[model samples]
Target: LGNVRGKDWRIQTNVYGNGSTTRGREERYLVPFDPTEEPHRYSILWTPDYIIFYIDDVPIREVVRSDAMGGDFPSKPMSVYATIWDGSSWATSYGRIKINYKYAPYVSEFSDLVLRGCRVGPIQQVDSADRCAEAVEELMSADYALLTPRKRAAMRRFRERYTIYSFCYDQHRYGNVTFPDCDYVSSEHSRFGEWGDNKFPPKEVRRARRRSRKPSAVDDQPSK
Candidate 1:
């Protein structure tokens, strides 16, 4: 699966393996600020145990690998890429909203690149995983790889305020079939309707949230 923006400009993180069309999952969220207005940090951290997606240093989503997941979790060498294109077919409103070329030359700039990993020639080599063992250990021990208690709380608050969709909780789409890696949280689950869409938080809760954080719920209007 690929990361893409929605018709309403919300960002989405997607993951899939062993046939994406049948087993892919996605999470959608709205950033606090206008991404187009300024440069912000976007990052993806993938390890053998878990994968984390971040925006401006804030951990937005994490997928923890589990034995029950089987081959659903991505477990192979991969390359990183960044680009901008018209994915009107599925990027926005399920293709109902086409990319209007009137605004030509849509540009996305990436810089100050940082990649951490052991380099190996090819996956066919039998010792590829063995050779990368040391690097994987070092990578897993890094500050970014481990989520502290404070960071976990931040992630929870961000999701409570900004998360719009989650495949793990989509009862209507996959009734009685919970994703193996899903860590069910009753409070979080209650926030989502049966269809997996977030039911807008109550007025009092929104007000309280606004008073507590810089990011307001007003900016989290879910896409139609």
Candidate 2:
């Protein structure tokens, strides 16, 4: 989802696996100033084990394929797609602002395209598909692979300062069922308020979190 002049790009992952859809795996980022007026490199690295986002080679976010997720994680092959259209209902300030038709033609630009992956055979066996994707993972995730400790620190700083919305922290909205990947093992997880969702942190841990040195909260809702 997107908002005009709102200074955020709510990138979401519609993880479809085995003909089913998994929701709420999303993030929001405060990109470089006036990116639309200029050009920025927005890159997504999808591997068999994780999903990583980068803006000009700086790691912004990471989502691991946890064992707890079962088939809910996106492990299938998909195409690269981009679209530009009107989202008056749920894109601008949670439907507050909308597209102004006076600016008739809004253009989304693209250049320096790079596509690298393998071509799996149709209806390939499960084991065969897994083997093929593993090889492709080495290529696709080479430069944009796992997050280093330093990069993770930088990411935490970014989210704490600029992230306006997040799903992992909203216990009141999502209730008891939270994804396993939400609980990062560091302070970066604090940006979500409750790193482990409602069911986590036990009683003692909850008290510890309440007395945390740097607290975070579910600051804002999504556009939808």
Candidate 3:
């Protein structure tokens, strides 16, 4: 349930089991990234329908919300997170690359962060109900939240060249059952019951993959 800056220097869109799930789900989407080179601006845009992950403002990954997800979807209020540490025991390609102590005191910089989330005061329980106020709705509906042709192309190219790991194609891991948003996503990006092997003909052939086709329902129920 976190993005780890592995020794490979690749930014992976990885998520383990959500807090509500029993067996921790293991999945990751690899993208072209190198944090050691220079400062790169990473951004996250979360809407009711999906959460978009961007590197230097170019969209690279999307986590779509769906009815099939049940409690596994990250529906409750969450906070922004960042970390810099020595996860050498288990971070890089499953601990293949151990952190060298010679490069001690690892430093991670943060700047120009943009966060927009609703505040519903205190919640007494996990099952409390919630809704976005008009002001919050306006914020989430801003143009930055929508998709464009160029961004879609960037996402497709990134996925085509870089998405090395995906849960949708890991049939053996999930017992061959597609989880959550795969019905609409991997089936289009990947081969039939296989890993993502499709090539994009033209940018136009690639549909706006992340835009929520229908406006998300505002009435939300709370969970971890």
- Evaluated with TM-score, which candidate comes out highest? 1
Residue-level lDDT tens digits of model 2 in 13-53: 33445557435554554443344445667777777777776
Separate clash counts for every candidate: 0, 0, 1
What lDDT would candidate 2 get against the real structure?
0.56
Order of the predicted models by lDDT, top scorer first: 1, 2, 3
Cα misplacement distance, residue 95 of candidate 1 (Å): 3.8
Cα TM-score per model: 0.80, 0.70, 0.68
Cα lDDT tens digits for candidate 3, 1-224: 12343322334564432455453334344333344544666777776677777766667677778777776766666656878766656445457766666766777787777667665455522433345655457766876566667566666655554454555665544665756665356445454234322233223211221221110111111222
Across 199-220, the per-residue lDDT of candidate 1 in tens digits comes to 8733333343333333323322
How does residue 110 of candidate 3 score in lDDT? 79
Candidate order by TM-score, decreasing, is 1, 2, 3
Positional deviation of 165 in candidate 3, in angstroms? 1.2
> Which is the leading candidate under lDDT?
1
Candidate 1: which stretches are off by over 4 Å? 1-8, 122-127, 201-224
Instruction: State the weakest 10-residue window (summed lDDT) of model 3.
Output: 212-221
